[model samples]
Target: MAAEAARQAFRGRFLHCLPEGGGGYRVEYLEDGVLVVEGARIAALAAAGAAELQGLDLASCIDLGGDLVVPGFVDTHVHAPQLDVMGSHGEQLLEWLERYTFPAEARFADEAFARVAMADFLDALLCQGTTSAMVYATSHHHATDALFAAAEARRLCLIAGKVLMDRNAPEALRDSAVGGIAESRELIERWHGRGRLAYAVTPRFSITSSPAQLAGAGQLLRDHPGVYLQTHLAENPQEVAAVRELFPEAAHYLDTYDAHGLCTERSVFAHCLHLEAAEIRRLAETGAAVAFCPSSNLFLGSGLFNWQAFAAAEVPVTIASDVGAGTDLSMLGTLVDAYKVCQLGGHALPPLEAFYAITLGNARALGLEARIGTLAPGSDADFLRLNPRDVPLLAGRVAACRDIAEEWFAYQILGDDRLVRETWVAGECRKRDGRLAVGN
Candidate 1:
């Protein structure tokens, strides 16, 4: 038997979500308990039955008393330095970036600022039950290091990198093609696959990166085959027009990245609100996943994302809290906005579908399905124990619900950080009794 199992404990009441198509998920009940320790992966449900706790001095048992236990949320896109600038009023994407995002990012040159902002970002994620994130750091390389360092100490699965841009922004945030490529390659070699960490080759967007810079970023992607590639595509009308002027040779917005080899199976493109049919087909063909930032889209008055387009193209979509422009760090808020976006587009993002998108759907998009995103045996036991009674609205909604599915809907639509009773990352609880406490 594994050493962690030697001193196993009760897992508490967990409602594990199993994916079912058409906005539906099946909840698995683990009333018996679950166990973990010694840096081991999550165990099988039946493993709880094999070990007896009476004979061994073991790790402390945490009884959740039938709280919901689902996989920790995986956010595909967020700008770490812009955490404080989230609610800045902006009319559109391009103006928002110029007026707010650029100035905010330039501050990351201060390591102290980066450290404090990163601390808040990570703690905010933990409070909301988000243990993994594919984040964007500023043009400052040290900022990226600060983010990875914080995540490493917490044992969280985090993917992040320095933002590469040569044009269309502040001089302080710009990097030449050669310089950016060198820095990105070095970062990938140093951090990729180190612990639960992955490195992302991030270009702000086609509008911000020159051809030379995009080419270098594409080359970096080739060199670091397993590292993720993240960028923006078709977010706002003016942004799309800017891409047209910048890359006149490319057929469309997605083609710019496709030509540079940045569009690939593991690449994640955010805010595909304006993708045309051909662009959608190419995205599907390239096996790229869309990081739908609904709140940001709405906040900036960018076009609404058509989930039906992704569905028709048969491309998987993941939800993200694209913070800074996105008002909240809560995945639940993102889902609620997703529901609104879908409804405005004459469709529905049901509760099960929203839960799955935040969990399994997101993990699969990041190619991290095997490591997390489910309660199956051998996956990491990173998840949250949520008290539906924690929030007054949630309590009222749950009181009216008839089953776990309806109760989950209440949490998804009405819940926020307050609903998160405790968060467990790699089987170590990080938050308990409404206080921040690291697990041993």
Candidate 2:
């Protein structure tokens, strides 16, 4: 059934975030809370039994027994077309594309196949507690449209773009400079700012897109302001070398994009693992966001992202699954990997900060924090019901928790899709039992 944007009330142990004095968050943990949802927006949040709610009708209330409701995860970097090629092993960046990635994407040329694949990908994302994402579709315009149409029907907050690769790639996946730019422009006109959807100007990366095509993409961004830019950079040593070989006139790998005005506040650079001090500072200075795919990085044997350096540079960073290459879809799993990634370097990821990274921080990175990130009033009602008691080890861990902070800490480290009891979007419960909670 399609979820109606109707008013409802939820009583649970709720977690929400507000900006603290600095860039950190002030977490509000309501032990016994009541959150009122009127249509797609959060109307009010208060402790249960508050007299202010006494006058409201209580029959519409839904009680989540001892489960925790937190904002849904926002994945800033994902490949909607590469769902079936995730675990193909033993190849670096360029070779992986030739061996596994490109071949899988070639199949998107069949529009029917694209539809089925995108539907399952969206379903997987919801089951994994990802309500909002910035995705990359294939080079086929119709294939990308299929992904957008799927997201539109579900009212998902998604930002996606068709891959623009004019030079390198198999004959089936390549589009000419003029043809690719025209297709992108048409897509932007058709889909940009449509409902909860936005369009990104995607150039697969320097390796696939020629200088002419990259320049064309930059022109598209200028022609339509606020359209996002998504692409890869410095993800692998060989990939970086390829970019240097391809764009020898540029000072660095980032300079390849900078020369064409692709670097902007709205741009999302995925897996910036081997960035230099100058690149880090430039990313901060330009207000461009970084999509940190720790799980994908580890799985591909790419270098570790220096999180502290990015943080110290005051750059905006968001966590993502980068799936098909990424091991799994769970944000908790991503956080667990992020924690391990940092721990290996003798650093710590505080659980509160980690939670904030997946939710509010990610929303902020996409410039959509005002719309989908928090349970704050007037924000969209997208969240997940986490049952810490659902898993055996998690149940025991929760039983020993000394406080709410400890409870969250245990959940972040131990939780995954198995811990997600339900997923809600726009005041409607959508997923349970690793599938749709409500059916048409």
Candidate 3:
């Protein structure tokens, strides 16, 4: 039976950064929350001017008391099983993936371990106001299944897949190309687009995956054009060297994936920090996106990514925490670190640009612009209510702000999980400090 629809609204002074204003917005005293059903995919958005909301009796209402209701964040790249491995230092890409990542991911063979870690990871994202993400699962198929089940129950938009690695990884964590492809196909049919769930065609990286595995991943991409492709790319010098060694016939680091059919509009390569000009052009040509993991880059001491180059080439870029290497789950902290990265590289990213990168911009890159990432009607009603005065430093900063843009900059510089007071997914108030803020 179809779910019964319900009307709901949140009345308060709300603020969300407009893409046109470049990370600023005009505050409005109004009501705008999600109109949903027990299982409706966001019936509509209710605000003063909408015709559909006219004279309709709301089922339940939440008074936000003038908190921000911007679109929820979209984290383009993260690892579900890497929750416990965050904050480890030194070792660059390949070595680190082997020394820390692979062994740790190997543990996900235990379904219980993956479940506990996934629960913590999802809760952290909710608390930090990230409603959607492209997450990575380890080689174990059950690990990916567990993540999908968790996201489905929570009604969060989560895309993930089992890592495709047939070589250069621990024996237990590796899978033959044939087995990997079969497992991925089965999972995609079962979970893709089930509620807010989607599947990604995840190859760990060119270094860890053999030619057969890369070929298999490419075939998967060709077979399922709607699913996303995610993997590491040009993240570190050593990893680049390894790619060259593995694919000596290929032109460059990006060429390995391109040689296979994996270079397409749905592909998202994390950390293109070290790339030649030609590679950027190829990325633009393929219409692929890059996930700029600033905190991870800094933490791993990977070289800085050239945003100017990305901009000049008109290549799409998304922001991600790249957790385990990235220090915090807060996109605000990642944005601040991104700003520092820009300053260090002799360029400055306007606070608005950084904000867009994590929100709407990221949505565009991930092919989710139509349904999420903005305040427009008909989009999924996922958002966060932020208290600019959530901290003493932020309180002072908010007091001095001349405009909303400056206030956003202040949050980018100082905001953390504490700044988020409420989180909503599809109009359901899923979390609030210690209580279930909204109920069905």
Best by TM-score: 2
Question: Which regions of candidate 1 are displaced past 4 Å?
Answer: 1-7, 18-27, 30-38, 46-61
lDDT of 3 by residue, 1-440 (tens): 12222455555444443334432333322344433323334454446345335764544545666566677889988887777778776687777887888878888888898887777778888878899999998889988888888888778889899889888888999899899999999999999978888889999898778888889888888787789899999999988888888889999999998989888989999999888888999999998999989999998889897888887787888899888888888888889888998898888888767777788889878878767777665677787778776688898988898866687889889998878877878767677774545332
Cα lDDT computed for each candidate against the true fold:
0.82, 0.87, 0.80
Q: Name the 10 consecutive residues with the lowest summed lDDT in model 1.
A: 50-59
Which is the better candidate, 1 or 2, if ranked by TM-score?
Answer: 2
The predicted structure with the larger lDDT, 2 or 3, is 2
lDDT of 1 by residue, 76-99 (tens): 998888877878764577778888
Cα displacement (Å) at residue 29, model 3: 10
Q: Locate the minimum summed-lDDT window of 10 residues in model 3.
A: 22-31
Question: Against the true structure, whose lDDT is highest?
Answer: 2
Query: RMSD, model 1, all Cα superposed?
Result: 3.4
Candidate 3: give the clashing pairs: none
* C-alpha RMSD by candidate, in order: 3.4, 1.7, 3.7
TM-score of each: 0.92, 0.96, 0.90
Residue pairs whose backbone atoms clash in candidate 1: 11-34, 15-69, 86-324
Ranking under lDDT, best-scoring first? 2, 1, 3
> Which whole-number lDDT from 0 to 100 does residue 430 have in model 1?
84
Candidate 3 local lDDT, residue 39: 37
